[model samples]
Target: MSSNEEEKLLSYNGEVLIFQLSQGDLAKEGTAKTCRLRVRRMTFNRSTSTFIQKSTGIFSMHGEYSGFEMICCSCAADFRTGINLPCVVIRRNKKKSVFKYFLLLLHSSNEFEQRMNFTLDYEMKDDIKILNGPSILWRHNRTSFYISSQNDTIVSAPVEFSSIKWAGEVENLGTILFGVGEPHSTNRESSERSSKSDYAVWGTEFYAYSVESQKILSGSYFLPHAYGSVVTCIHICATKVVNTVLRISLIALTQKNQLIWFQDGIPKNLCQLPFQDPCALQVMASDGGDLLYIVSFRSSDVCAIWKKNFQVASKWQKVKSVLVDDFVGTGTEQLLLDFKDTFNTDCLTSFKITDLVDVNYSNDAFDPMENDLFEHNLQENYSLTVQALERRLQIGLTNIQELQKHLLLKERVLSKSCKALVGLVQGKAYIPPYEEKDILVSLCGEKKQLPHSLKEKSSDTYHDSEHVIEKMWYRVLEDHLVVGVEIKNSFLSFLNDVTLSLLMDQVCTSNPPIIQCKNSVIKLDKVSFPATLSSPCETESVAKRIKLTLHNKERKNSFHDQSSDANCIQVFTVVTALSPLLAFHNFCCIVMLHARWGENSGRFGETCTVPCGKLSLSIEDISSGKYSVTLPEKNKPLKEPMEDLCTLLAVFHKFCFQITSPDCTLTSVKIWLLRHMECETVKEFPDSFLCKSLGALNGTLFSWKQKSPFEGILTVY
Candidate 1:
């Protein structure tokens, strides 16, 4: 054969016919009676003329004959007696032309034919192509056969059957559907008299094998009637039944050994049928095998078809029903139905599969209960999410509050530390050093008592002659100065009065000095002595002998009360005033005191000179009163005695005086002597001999003469 002819034969799209030559036909044709399959290719020639003929003409074309060619022909022992019903199992591998073919053969004898006469076998290896793996077959007798790639047999033990009557394999489900026959009756008399028709019955129980569990599960349902008791045939598509819409039929034996029919492994009565008794039950499934079309024979000339629509709920709905003639044909895109009557009247119609099946169902078909359940679950999830967020928020707030409290405590500690640091820098705060002794004992002693006044003085007398300033102290604090003076007196004479004064000299040469005074003058003669001390004289004489008292003196009369006995009387005074230290960089403080004595009447009634003294105070020495200044020598004469005496008399009514030289060589001395005696020798004794003699004399005789002349040359004799 040419390559083109071989290719055309192999690629033929039309059906190839298989013929079995009988012994008589083979003898008559004088040929080998081999069963074989053949293909006949047809071809036509087209006219190539392009010219248009204006005149009408008859066109004729001849067809060439393409004789039948042998494609798949076999003469093996299995096909020697001719094959029975055969099924082709296409291999899943598209690249291979190998296939598994199963053949059911019946070897019948008169007696065994009424019983089990069928033998089923399959062939996987051929001269054309080889199968790579094993093929498995499980039979109704509980035996499993495995044919390996080497064609070796692997036989397993018998498995127990869940039902007594084995129907057949449900090819779509890859499981065997079985049935249980009804129980036998015990009445032998009724059974013996009954006709053969009375023995026919239907199976009561059914089951289908579960591939996953390797067990049989129930698939039984009730039946309607038993008029046609035995099942004549069964047709099931190799499509798995997922929804209730698809259908399958099988034949089984009853308990009495009678045959019966089962649809979908269940009794026909329990199934929801579209029509009562379907003369022709045609089940057309969708490409996806989810929908089923059950076409029933309605009348002799009319047919009705019901389409079962599958839903998401795993339930089916009879969505469409239509009537047409008993003619059905399927094309790629349309279904052709040719209706013909008994009288030969014919009509044709075509429908799209989508239209016949009612592909678009109403919205009401969705289960409302399921939607409500879904919403409920969604709400529950949302609530849980909200609650979780709230819990997290609460925890966050708690942590924040704790952090705030911690921050506040830290701030307080920082503030206290800052205050302590400030105190140390300013020097206003003091902390005592730690000591071994009790703190209370160390704090005791002479404390600095607050001074109510600026200055205070107190005096005490120990003996009748001695006088001493016991305590004299001052403090300069802030803007005020406080001076304290205490005096001790022990003189034997009466004290007429006492005067205390503070003299401040400005350090600047241009400013004048300031003097502040407080006087305690004796204005009364009543003197009060302490009861604890015994006077040197009797109590009655004490009052008469010493009449010391106190009185404030005006500033103008500050020098008028200098009559106290300086050695006997004591004065205590406090002076408080605003300090001059704030305004002056340096200043001098002099404490001046004056004491006067009364005359002693019993001893010639001589009155003593008034006593006065001054104390200079330094800023450092004021607190302790331990400084002293020496008095100038009394024998030293003043450079200008007359001027010095006049200034001294102006400040104090009674002040200490010291005369140095009485020699006549110092002319000022002669002049001072004349002035002391209130004798103006130059003027009163002018041109007199005494004045000249005194003025001219410069030796010791001159000093004596000067004094004698002042005495008025007293002792004449």
Candidate 2:
């Protein structure tokens, strides 16, 4: 079956996407089942947008236009439905800066249409500078204004376009102040007397900036003592003051319970909390008279504060308070409490944090094998219990097998047999079986012991060499004695000129040896003959012959001794010259020759030239201390070299061999020699060797040679 079909057959049912609930928050479907959920269908619609139904049967909407539509509610409708709802619309015109435009809009949707707006003017400069007011803000070229409501909470996420609406709310939208924050005096007497009134010191301040830059695009009014309490949030008012510039109000509270208000750097108002302890505070802008809201946490209780003056407020009032049980566990619920600080918006309705989505594993699409999941799992000791059990079972099985092997060894020793034999050679005692002798032999060769009275020789007299030889001959039976079994270094050492020339004469006389060299040929004829022997000790005869040939030219010519010094290179040439000594030996009793390079290094070459005309050659680079080659056998039997010849010769640059033969005539037989030696090395003897060994013992000798002395062939005996 195909792989896909196999997978389909193997997969089980009931997969799920699980979500976790936090704190006391609970999630329930319309049907009340809660363990797992799957996305059957999803939509974006109005009735379901931001509308969450809790397990406690309470319904809340965070924003009228922002929420995901449920998959199966059947109430899923177009998101456009929110545009026509009874919501207030506040619009403001944007003032352009170097990086961005700042505008403010605010509205309430649940009750009658309530709206608020703010207009901010700022210059394009290195650092943003405000020119006038955020009080009379405008959007779509409309000046900011608002409709009031009692029950609705106004909020928005900064990412949504409606965050502009949240920025424009004013606590008292209809009110306008004169001279920034304090009302301007119409009577001359009042203007002069106003300097003494505490209310006359009031002022408004505006802060504007793009959220991403974390920069103040503009602040029409100053924030005093900005050290401890950062500007966590800002709310711009829509109504203009008597001076025609927008009335901007700022509400800033320190962590130490001190609060201040300013208009264009002029201090207008100040207040202090009833308690001296510090608190964590968050701010969110809202609609209608409640312009800005603050959430503060003191110990285990969270408190909310709202400021209502259109310009500057002399005091702040508490709007809500709630208590929490577990401090750390309620961090998420605290997020809802502190939403205004981070986003400059508030959760319009208080939420119980119904559910939290699962903490997704990061590598959902990664391949498990590629990621080494199996290896990681194996590293976990707690997860390997089953695998550990299987490993123990395997070890137990191996122990049983070892026990069986021990029992088998005992049985084999008990059943082994004992066998023996005896013999005599020329009246001397002998052992029937000798080293290298065939283990299986007939009892017919066994001899009985002789009577003791037949002889007695003195032990001192028996110590003589002749007696030793006699004893050896008689003590070893013919079946047990191996005669003339020599271990030549390796087969290649037998190829030398002294043997090759003798063998060539035995096989051929009419022509020169047919040597193949670079597809060229050279012939030798009528050459003055010098008898040469392969034994290094035979220079006695070679010197005499050279002297004889040059007797007539002695007075006028010079002489050079060619045999005075021979290097390892010359020795290798000398050895590789003999190939026929091993030609006619027994089919199985072959010789092996071993020789090293110039410095006696371990590197050496081996060639097995068998009795039946088959030659297998191997050259090795022995730094790694191992050699192997295959020699192919066809007409006879051989395996080819196990390694390439090139690597062999590269190390053991030079080497030698030797062989012996009898005399032959050059007048009758014709001989052909075919050599196969292909090796790639810096130093190469790029020529094949072909020669024959002739004559029963001695008679006439003919030499096979190449006429060109400078090519590759080096003839040495």
Best by lDDT: 1
Error of 2 at 428 (Å): 99
Model 1 C-alpha lDDT per residue in residues 300-359, reported as the tens digit of each score: 222223223221112222222222111112221112222232332211111111223322
What is the model-wide C-alpha lDDT for candidate 1? 0.30
| Number of backbone collisions per candidate | 24, 58
For all the candidates, what are their Cα RMSDs to the real structure? 61.9, 40.5
TM-score (C-alpha) between model 2 and the true structure: 0.18
TM-score of each prediction? 0.21, 0.18
Task: Tell me model 2's lDDT, rounded to 2 decimals.
Answer: 0.25
Q: CA lDDT of each candidate?
A: 0.30, 0.25
Give me candidate 1's TM-score against the actual structure: 0.21
